[model samples]
Each structure stands twice: as structure tokens, then as C-alpha cells.
Target: MATSSSTLPSLVVRMLRHGRLGPGLATLDLGTGAGGLAAYAARRLGDQHVTSIDVDPYLTEAASERLARMGLRPTFHAVDATAEIPGHYDRIVCTVAIRPGTGLRTVLGALHEGGRLVTTLAGTSLILTGWKHKTGELVGCIERGGAEFMLTRSGHDYPPALSELFAVASDEAGDETGTGRYPVMDVANAWEVRSMLEITTPGVQSRYSTHDRRRTLLLIHADGSWARAIGEWTDPPTVHQGGPRRLWDALERIRGRLNMEGALPLYGAHARVTPDGVVHLSRGQWSGSLGEE
Candidate 1:
């Protein structure tokens, strides 16, 4: 079971302020692991309109008890949000990241026509918010900042870690060695840049570290793709790429595109979710789409 129910204070404030959790709105807290957000919603929306759920019976029971200890009582259920969402709500806030098209539809179906939902996608840090429309679509924009939530789970634990793939990626002889076009930029720390790369070439994981005067950047993907770059602070680094995809090449291309455009696409972009739950994002002359599959 994913323990994503506890919304941190800063993010809670941000979501409440930026996500438009208006007064007296009936809200559903999807994946209520520790019931923090559920309790807050109960205080704001009244317990009658607050329904929290999780797939873990133990989590739901504990969360139910935790809410009662605060003298706040809202409905709690051990239900799969992607399979069975109980009642229609004016605001459905999900803590667990969901696959976009297929699983997202399940959450949208539980929202009232004018209601809204706030969530991030699995493996990326973009906080997406959407408003349900009478036309059977959800329209909104990505929040300026992002969040990472554990994916909702049906079983007690996730499938085995990707350690086996990582093992081969660590020391495999990469296919090419060349001078990097850009210096080892702070790719991982820069959320916007990292989020863009993750969106475009999904599943590439990155790490950065400094040893002596040299800076290193490592990229690995579950699909046997890997890249390594080593350079000084101001110099172009040497790069090696292995497996099928050119992981570092993808990052460099995205960097060039962003440098030319002068901005990240996460902010002020139009987000349109079709009936099938595909989220289309566009701004000015640029566009991107993310789907569950």
C-alpha cells in the first residue's frame, strides 16, 4: 500500500491556495494513508462532504481512527480509486500519482461537471490540475511547481525494484564517447528541465555528484538505456551512451530547445483532457501530450 495520504504543510498550503480548493466544496481525498488532507478537508468542507479512501484495510482503519481522534469523522474506505470511486464530489484531490488516460478517467468520472482534481503523474514531478466540463472534458493548466507521489497500488508492495537492470547499467561499456555539447548542467536539481526530459524521454533516471574538481552526471533507464558524463564546472564533459536510446543526446536536445524558447512548458500552458483521459498540453506554438499507456 502507498502511504501518500499525508500532504505536507507547504504543499497543502500551495494546493489550497493555487489549486483553488474553494470554500464549502465537497472533496474526496484519494489514497488517504495517514488522513492529514482528509482531516483538513473535514475541517473546511464539513465531514459530510469529505470521503477518504485507500486500498489497504489497515491504512484505512488507522486513518479512520486518526480522524476520529481529532474529533473529525469522514467516510473512509479501502477502495481502489482507479476501480471504484464512491460518490461525486466538487473537488477530488489525489495524493497517489495515477497513470493518465486509463486510470485518470476513473477519477474524473467521480467529479461533478464543474469539479476539479489535483494530482501528479507517476515517475515525474508535474502537479496537474483539471476541471471537469459539461462537454465531457477536463480543462486546466499544470501548476508552476511539481510534486512526486507514490503510484497507487493494488497489492501490499510494489513489484521488485529495478536493481537487476541497474546492475548492468552501472559498468556496461557505452556505445559512444564524445564531447558533450553542454556542460554538466544541474539537470536533476532543476525541476523544470528534469520534468521536461522525463516527459519527452520517459523512464530515464539521473544522478549528479562532484568528486574533487570533476562533476559527474549519470543517466539510466529501465529499458537498458544508460549514459555517463564527466566534466569540470565550466567545461564541456565527455559522454558515453549505451543500450538502445541516446539518453544524454535526448537531454542535450531538450536543453537546446528550451534555450531557444526561453521558458519551461509547465507554466501558463493550456491543459485539455479528452474523454479518453489523454492530457494535451500546449502554449503558443509548442505542445506536448501525456497518456497513461
Candidate 2:
């Protein structure tokens, strides 16, 4: 079975808080890995009103056994979350991120009008919440804080990553060579920067490493573009990029904006998820989207 980890208690509480779960309300605890969220909800709101589902039958079955021993028996199901859910819910709190197109639409379709949904956007750590409206739209804002969660899968295992492209990025001396203004930093560890990059330039895979005093950062895209930057600690790196686009330049521009503007426009921005599953984000004069129009 695919590796599954339980959601931390602190994060579970935070997500449940945003869900505003209450007694007599039917809550769907999506991604029931260790059944942490399901257990919490079943206790507070009666097990009959809580339903937990996961793609892996092992996780759901194990969680069911444990929760049963604890005197809680919320409904459990082993199913693909990206497909149609079985029942409507007053509140749907997903422990996994949902891709911004069909997966999102499936979840929203399972929510009753006036219901609420909380889930992170795929490719980002953004915590997005929305209230089901009579117009078949979900209207809400990106909350201030964020959480990293695995994306929903339709099968027993996730698809392969861009490992070949990553390998090419590590060795290629490309069409353009230059020096970056910012030092080589671990993009994976910088949540805000990484999240913004995913929002603006979706599907950019990154790898970072250090050896002795030398640090390197590599970025690769599915479109055959790749960039490699290497430098000593705290100093700007020599950048090498090849492909259809200059990937390093894009990262620098994002870094430059953060250095110049002090913040990104993702968090606290108003988010509107249409029935078509497009997420439109707007903050003041800036705007962005997760899926195509």
C-alpha cells in the first residue's frame, strides 16, 4: 500500500475550526489516514453524522478498527476522492489537497447549498475555504495560514514525478548562462515562496542540495525547460538554464517581488470557485487563477 501518515492533531484542530463543525451537522472527513479528524468529529458531533473516506482500504479499515475500540463508529469508506462522493454533507473538511479542476468540482457537488468546504489547493499549501451558494458557486477567501497535504489520488499509487527532467537539469549547461542576484536557497523549505511559485507557474518541480559549503538548486518543468543554480553559502549562484523558457529568471522575478513588495498576493485574497471548478483569486488590483477559464 502507499505510505500514509496521520494528520497532526494541531493541524486537525485548525482545519476543524475553519470547518466550524457543530452538533447535528453531517461532516465528511476526507482522507481518513489515521482517523484523527474522524475521531475528533465523531466525539463532538455523534458518529452517525460523520463520514470518513480514503483511497487506501488499509488506512480506512485500520482507522475504523481503532476508532471502534475507542467507542466511536463514524461511517468509513474506501474510495477514490476525486470521483463522485456518495452523499451530501453540511461540512466537508479534506485532509488532502484537491486539484483545481474535476476533483474540486466533485467535492463541491457533494456539498449542500449553504454548506462549507475546507481543503488545500493542489500544488500549493494554500488553505482554501468556501461556502456553497445558491448560484452553484463557492465564495470565500484564502485563509491566512496554510497547511501542506498530499494531493488526492484516483488509484493505489500516485503517478511518477519528473525524475528524468530533474536528472537533465542536474547536468545540462544550457542555452543561457548567468549569475543570479539571490543566493541559492532551499525552495522546498520556503513555504510562501514555493506556494506563490506553484500558483503562478504550476507544475514546476524543484530540488535543492548542499555539499560542503556549496549549495545547488534545480528546477524542471514538464514542458522540457530546466534550470540549475550552484553557489557557495550566502552568495549568489551561477545559473544555467536551457529549454523553451528561462526557468531561473522566473524564480528570480518571484524573489525580486518578495524582496520589493514584502508579501505575496495569495494569502488573505478572496477566492471564488465556480461550478466549473476554476478558482479565481483577487486581492486589490492583482488577480490569479488555478485552472483554465
Candidate 3:
């Protein structure tokens, strides 16, 4: 049976044990994969307490076999987890990344009050664990580091490749371009921005270079956008960009405010999930959103 790295299973186990599951607690393992979690939990919490689900029948079969070998028997189901999760779970642990909108809402709804949820958001594999404080309110923080996993298959995966969207647009010709400075703040890091844009607009890519010449350019598009800059407050930047929004401008604005305020915060950012699977973020004066098929 396929299994996550030893470290992840161990970390997950640690987190589960910390949460302290016992008799009468229903545990659901979404995207059970090889059922390592189910097997582990069954051994700790008892076989009848664990129920695992995955979209692939092969994975389910493998997990069943693996768990049986471990001398534990847990119910296994093969169903599209993104569509619906059967029964409520006191502790719902998703081994896969969840898309925004309905998929996210569905998983959130599957938890009982005060139920614990540990899952990954798009862009980063860092686990985010939270408890249902109340209906419509889930609070959690991201765990340090990252993990790599296949995306849930029910929705659009990566945005289209960058090569597919490379084209000369008549409207882009002779558009005003200029150089600018971007002073990054504490919370808004380059990796986070790039990851967010890549997931939101997959076609967008970036290259950062700093040699004798210091420069930063943010390129964006329908597929997505990328930003690269150099000099790091040492020299002026030479910026060139071509896309729907002035990519450099957005970066500079975010950076400038962060520098002045001493913090670049995404927390409390207003988020709206559209029915068709789009995530919109708005906070105070800033607003942006992305759509996916």
C-alpha cells in the first residue's frame, strides 16, 4: 500500500494523540490513500472507531489489505470525497488539498461542533489544524514546513501551463511601463505571493535575477502573474511588465503599506467563495479574486 513519508504519519499521529480521541468519537480520514492513518488510529482508538475514504478503489483495496495485516479492521469506502463525505466525524483529517468554495465548505460542514480538522490549503502543503469554535467559524494556524501531494481530482488542478498563454496582444503594444520599488513586509513573503498567484493564475510564472544590474519585473495574465525584483533597497529597479493588471504596481502597493505599517497581514482578509469555485479576497482597501473551472 502507498504511504506518506514516515515523518508525516508520525506528525499526524502526534497531532491526533494530542487531540485525544476516545470511545464515542467518530473519526473520518478523508483521502485515506493507503490507509496508514486508519490503521494507526484503529490500533490506538480501536478498529470500529475509524472510517476511511478515498476516491480510488485501488487505494481503498490496498488500505483494506494493509490494515488487515496490522490486525485492525476499519470500514473503507471509495467515493469522490469532494462531492460528499458520508456521516459527520468528530475529527476529520484530510490527507489531500482542498479547493476553495464548495469543496472547502463541504469539508467544513462535515465536522461536528468542536471537531478538529487538519488539512492543506492550495499553494502550500503546510498542514492547517483548527477546531470548529461555532457554526461558520473555524480557527486554526498553519504548521511550519511543507508537504507534496496530488491534488484532489474533482476540480481543476494546476492552471494551464505558461507556454500555452504566450501571445502578442495588440492591446499590450505600447502600453505605459515604468520602474518601481517594492519593499516587502514581514508577512508578505515572495514565496507566499508566488504560490498564491500560481494557484490563482497558473499561467503566470516569475524569474528573479540580481547581478551587476538590479531589477524587478512582475508579469501577469489570464493564466496568472509573476514578479521578479532585485537590488533589495540597494539600488533602483528596472521593471518591465505585460499583463491585465500592472503586476509590479500591485506588489509595490502591498510592500509600501506593509513597510509603513510594519506588518503585512492576510488575516481577517474578507474571503468570498463563489458557487462555481472561485476565491475572492478583500481587506480594508485591497481586493482581488481568482476563478477556476
Candidate 4:
């Protein structure tokens, strides 16, 4: 089992301060893993006021022992976070990744008006602090940097196996595949694009690799469409593409536009999250969304 990183304590503390947690603010640490964040918050705000909870009794016991070593006694509860949260809290911080339809609306309802909730959506760690702008929108931005956390264990670690969706093709056949090129905007800095697509687009994964002897390879996907490119500059790139859509061509067009404009901006892109965790992206007149099997 991997432990939460040591830097998490200070990171959580900074997020707390960013969210404006003061001397009297009530704090709840959800998924308190080894009690690292709990202990750090307790020391910062005093143990009597911090409440820590986890679904696993063993994790609770380990957190208890860890807190004891720090000479801090924060209340620890063994309860399923997906079910019900004990009481309303001024600030709720979760150290686990939340999937779609995990009762996030219920958890958000538990926060007092003007109270803030900080947690990870999918796998990206974000700090959302809003004053309940109304009934529907809880608007916030991604915290300065990114943080990684483990998923809660309500079931087995690995999800049930997925049915085979594609047949493997020979390298020779794959090499002869049709290719297209598009000018791609700088997506590396676009966290929103990455997070939204990962959530909405099933089977979509990306890999970024730079070779010592060649240009970098940035791969993007969804279902059958696969796009691969070499080098960051120069058009008519070496591209190997296959599938339903000419994905490499789409990428080339985006890249060409980026080169024309001198830069591609990701913030101008629009994102929509479906109830089923699918993400749709639209920019200017071009748009695409994730599809299910």
C-alpha cells in the first residue's frame, strides 16, 4: 500500500489558508489515510476542533496511532463517506479521488453556506471554494499546482475487467494506416482539457515522451481514433494515424492554426461535464465530446 506523500501536509495547510480557514473554522478531513493531513491541520488549528473520518476501520486505527505519536487527539470516525457525512462543517477537505455519481451533491449539501469544499475530481486535485452562488453552480479554479491521491476502496482495487473493444492489428497493417495532421494547441498546460477528456472519454489515454535521438511523441486517443506525431515544430509531420476519424489530420489542423496565431490558448475552450462523467469540449466552431461504448 502506498502512503500519502509527505508534502501533502504542507500542501493541505496552504490550501486551508488559501480557503481562509481561521482559528474558529470547523474542519473535517475526509479519507484521513494515515492521519497526515488531519494531524497537520490539528496542529495548525488545535486538535479539539479537527474531525477525521475514513471508511476503513484499519485505516482509522492507523490514523489514531499516527495522531497519538504527534500528541494530538483528533476525533476519528469509521464511516463510509459515500453514504452520509456526520455533521455540517465549515470546511470539508477530501484526500481521495471522487468519481461521477458518488453523491457529491449530497456531500456539497452538508457544507454550510459560504463554506468551502476541497477535493479531487477524477484524479486532479482542486480546491473549490464558493459561497453557494445559487442552487446549481459551485464555481472555482484549479489550485496553483496539482496533487495526487488514492481512490477510496469500496470495492476491489482494480475495476472489473472490461470486455475487449478492439482487435489487435499487425505492426505492418498498423504502419500502412491512413494519416492526417492538425496543428495542435499547447495542451500540456491545459489541465482542464486533460481532466475533462479523461472523465468523459472512455478508453482515452495520453503519453508524452521525448527521445534523446528524436523529437517528442505526444499521443492522444479516444475509442478507435489514434494519433501519433514526432517533433514540435515544422509541418507535414511524421504521423501514423488510424481509426474511424482522421484524428492525426484534425491534430495537424489545430497545429497549423496554432502556428498561424503564434500560440494556442486552452482557456478559451469550453467544457461540459455530463451526469455520467463524460466531458464535451468546444472551441470556436470546432467541438467534440466523449462517447460511450
Candidate 5:
């Protein structure tokens, strides 16, 4: 069900602004969906300075033809971005979200020293924009604004979601049951909470639904962790959690912090991505890391 979509023009402009595109700089339009970003960069920076890449050959070929018709022809490549990117770039702006792994490392490795990278982390709306530091880390801050993008993939489709766990969570009783401190919410719609949760506890999939005056939220992790909550719209839900961790409790902790502090540490946080693909984020006394040992 997950498919790539063209980024809106406003967002394309926003990403380019964060990328800091300028004259004569070699730029790579990563994830050249619909070629909007590629067209803009080629027009301003000239076609020779702009290169666009996509995992799908069809997209690469189609976009190449369409942009050529528009009198813009940036270099186009059909390759898996997570593997090995062909060339170094002064500025890399990815329209797709990437998890912290080989894909992220590939993007980081393709940047020249002092180059800038603007992309979102997969499964979260956190837009990370940073410059390649002398020490090889990408150091910058998470933008106060957020965006949602389709995750980058190596093939025709994304990996399957944790549907089996979702099925179990829906029917089975949990090892622990209690009343929640907060009302049952569509966690995916609560962007900051969802983003912070993903940072703290990755690989969790969330599903939410409502019926009459009731609402239900389900969280399932690939590690066999699961949580289910059902209650009235404005009321705290009865929560059930099971497996290696209490998923509901983890979410409640994040929610409690948000209520206590009035904001999350994710937004406007200082971020550092090491050469090995680990991401470290800090905001004042609160700190978190992803893909760490």
C-alpha cells in the first residue's frame, strides 16, 4: 500500500531552501519524484551541475524525458540510493525519508566536506538538515517544522508491516492491563508524540480506529511487543500491553513529558549523525539516539 508520491511545490521550495542551493554547486536531487526539485535546481544551477537519482528506472526515464521537454536536462540515474551513490555532491536534498542504516550512510558518504544534507527520518515527520562537518559527522538541528514523506526503498515495494502482531494485539489479552493516564488517541495524527516515540522506540507500527463514542489505538513492534487501548473519545483508555516491553507505558511516558514540558525535545533539537549512521539528538537536558550501540 505504500507508494511514492510527488512532493508539493511548497515543500519542494522549502527543502531547496534548507539545502541552500547556490551557483556552481554540484547538487543531487535524491528521490526525483516527478522531477520538480530537479527541474528547479537545473534551471537555476544549470543542468550540468544538477544530478537526479531514483530507485525506479521508469521514474528516472520518464522524468528525464519530461524535463528535457521543459528545456531542462539534469543527469539522471536509475540506482538503489541505499547502495552506492555514483558521485559526490555539494548539496543533497532527499525528498524521501530514510531509516538510519545503509541507506542513510550512503547519503552521508556522498556529501563533500562542508556539504549540506536535508532529509527526513523514516517513520517520523522530523526533517533533519545538517552540514557535513570536518570530523565527518553531519551536525545540525531538527527543523521546528515537520513533514511526512514516503520511505525510500531498494525495490518495487516496501517491506511488509507488522500485521500479524496487530492481529494478535486486537484479539489476545495482554500480560498487563490497567487504565491509561491519557485518553486514547490516534498516535499517528499526534505528530510530535509519534515522532518522539519512534526516536525512543523504533520499529513500532501504529493503527487507530473509532466507532460511535469509542476510540481504539494499537501499537505493534517487530520485537513481538504489542499494546491495545480502547475507550471513549475524551476519556482515558483501558490499556493492555504485552511481550518484552510495555508499549503503552512507553508512549504514556512520552505523552506525560509533553504534558509536563509543553513540547518535545525532537523539534528544534540539536542533531548529529555519525559516519557510521548513528543519530544523536539533544535538547537541553533531554537527549536521545538512534542506531546506536
Candidate 6:
């Protein structure tokens, strides 16, 4: 009951394309919300070769029941994926985003040698794919057209939400409001731009709204940082920001960089995650990292 039955057809197709599925190769689908990906895999790789797991018993039960009706029965487990899995697999595709340094090592341990695991990072929209080496590590990169998924969780519900951060952001007015150098840009809607902003500064959530014909973009972080921009995107918007950090300026800087470079930096970078879950990305001098979870 903690999950809804939903399917991103495009995401399923993209995941399958990069999953590297082959005949007779055992596959594991982690976080099987409604078993869409598992059923998709069952069609290509056969039900006997697929195993799907989720932390919610209701989800597992519902998925198992649905698959049975289709005459395709895949083994389903209502267990935590961050813990030791019941068996090994040739390919592990996680539908939920995994935080850096959080249970990624254990998931990799469940893969056979040279097996592939595809997942997105928790804080950013970077789809990472890696091959498990006999040396007990996974090396991969930011796949093209990155994905966003629900964060991997153990409990029935998400943690006490971002309400506190949003409350502060909605009320605070500390920094000066001035004409922005660039026209108001919808940064959150642009995937590449949003991904760059996220990787550069994690844990920032954005909310955009409109009231009485005027648009507003609000930026909030758990660290008491907040910023707001009000006006049309094509016009110079008034920006008000406060807290320990300059949030709007950071976004403007990224927009400026993208204007010069013609693209964001994260899409094609090489990613290397050690067993301890330290993620390093480098493509030329543009190197960055996601610290341990």
C-alpha cells in the first residue's frame, strides 16, 4: 500500500535497452513498485529468470498476483534490498534511486562477475550503469538521458518531509532583490540545467508556482538557504534570497556556463564508485564527486 501502480513506458524501454539482458541470464529488479519492469523483463528473458523484490509486502503481493494473472510468474520477495539478497543475478536493475554510500556496495555484491547494474543517483538525475568485476567493484558512467526515481527506502513512508525547509523559504527575505543578469529561466524544467545545479549543490529542492498571472520560482534547502524569483521567464525577474548561501546566484552561474559551453557537464562523465560508496566522476579537467551518504 505504500506504492502506487505506475509505469513509465519510456523509462522501461530505456532501462531495458541499457540493462544488457541476454537469454538465460538471471536478472533482479529491485524496488518493484508494480512489477512493470519485471514483467517487461519476463517477456524477453522469461519469468523463471527474473526475480523482483520490494520492501513492502503489499507491493510484492500485488505484483505477484498481477503477474500470475498474465501467466508470467516471477519470484517476488518483500525484503529489504540494502541487505543481503537471497541469490545472485547476472543483471540488477534498480528502479529506485540509491543514495551515495548507502547500501550500494551490498547491491553490487549480489551481482555475478561482470554483471551489470543500472540505477540513478539519489540526489541527481544521473543514471549510472556499472559492471561488477571479480575484484568486487563497479565502474560505470552517467548514461545518456538520465532518469529520476523514488528514493530507495526501508519504511512504509518517506521521512518527515521537506516541510520545514519549505516553511523557512516561504517566509524568509534576507538578501537584496535586484535585476538578474539573465532573463528568468525555468531551471527546474530543464533536465540538463537542473542536473548540473543538483550535482554542484545537492539537497536543494525547487518549487515553481503562479498566482494572478505572475510566476515565482522558489528554492529551498535543508540548510536554511532559500531564494525566490518572481516574474515572467522571458523578462528580468526580481530575485530575493537569504540564508548561509547565495542560491539564485549559483543558478545564474550555471546558466552562464551553459550559454558558453552549449551543454551541461554531467551527461558524459565517467563515474567510478568504490566498494565503500565513494563516487568519482571525471571527464577531462571537469572532475567532481558525491560524498559518502
The Cα local distance difference test for each model comes to 0.80, 0.91, 0.59, 0.57, 0.91, 0.81
- CA RMSD of all predictions: 2.5, 1.2, 6.0, 5.5, 1.0, 2.2
Residues 1-293 of candidate 1: C-alpha lDDT, one tens digit per residue: 33444668777656655546766788888878677788888888789878888888898899888889989999998887768788888888878887777778788888899998888876567888888899989999887768767787766776655665555555666788889999897676777788778778876777778987888888888888888888998799988888889999999988898889887767767888887778888988878877736
Q: Count the backbone clashes (under 3 Å) in each candidate.
A: 1, 0, 1, 17, 0, 0
Residue lDDT tens for model 4, 100-206:
34445555656676677676555333333444334433444345455556655553243432223222211213433443354233344455544444433434444
Please give, for residues 1-293, the per-residue lDDT of candidate 6 as tens digits. Answer: 24444659889878877889999999999888988999999989999999999888999999999989999898999887766677999999988877777578778778899899898877677898988777777888888787778887777776766877776666766666676777655566777777777777877888888766677888877788888888774677888888888888888888998899888778878988787766788887798777555
Deviation of model 5 at 3, angstroms = 2.3
Predicted structure 4, TM vs. truth: 0.65
lDDT of 1: 0.80
Q: In candidate 4, which residue ranges exceed 4 Å CA deviation? A: 1-7, 100-103, 123-127, 133-137, 160-193, 199-203, 207-293
lDDT of 5 by residue, 1-293 (tens): 74568889999999999999999999999998899999999998999999999999888999999999999989999989988899999999999987786678889999999999999998789999999998999999899889988889899998888888999999989899999999998999898999988888887899999999999999999899999999998898999889998899999999999899888888899999999878899999988887664
- Model 2, CA-based lDDT: 0.91
Error of 2 at 156 (Å): 1.7
In model 2, the runs with Cα more than 4 Å from the true position are: none
- Candidate 3: tens digits of C-alpha lDDT, residues 1-293: 23322236765675565456777788987877667778777887788879998777777898899778878898898877778888888887777777655677777777887787766655444455667765455665444444455556653233343543333321233244455564322222354554444443443444433445443333545633333333454555545455456555665655566568764434444444433435555557866554455
Query: Runs in model 6 with CA error above 4 Å?
Result: none
Ranking by TM-score: 5, 2, 6, 1, 4, 3
On TM-score, the candidate that comes out on top is 5
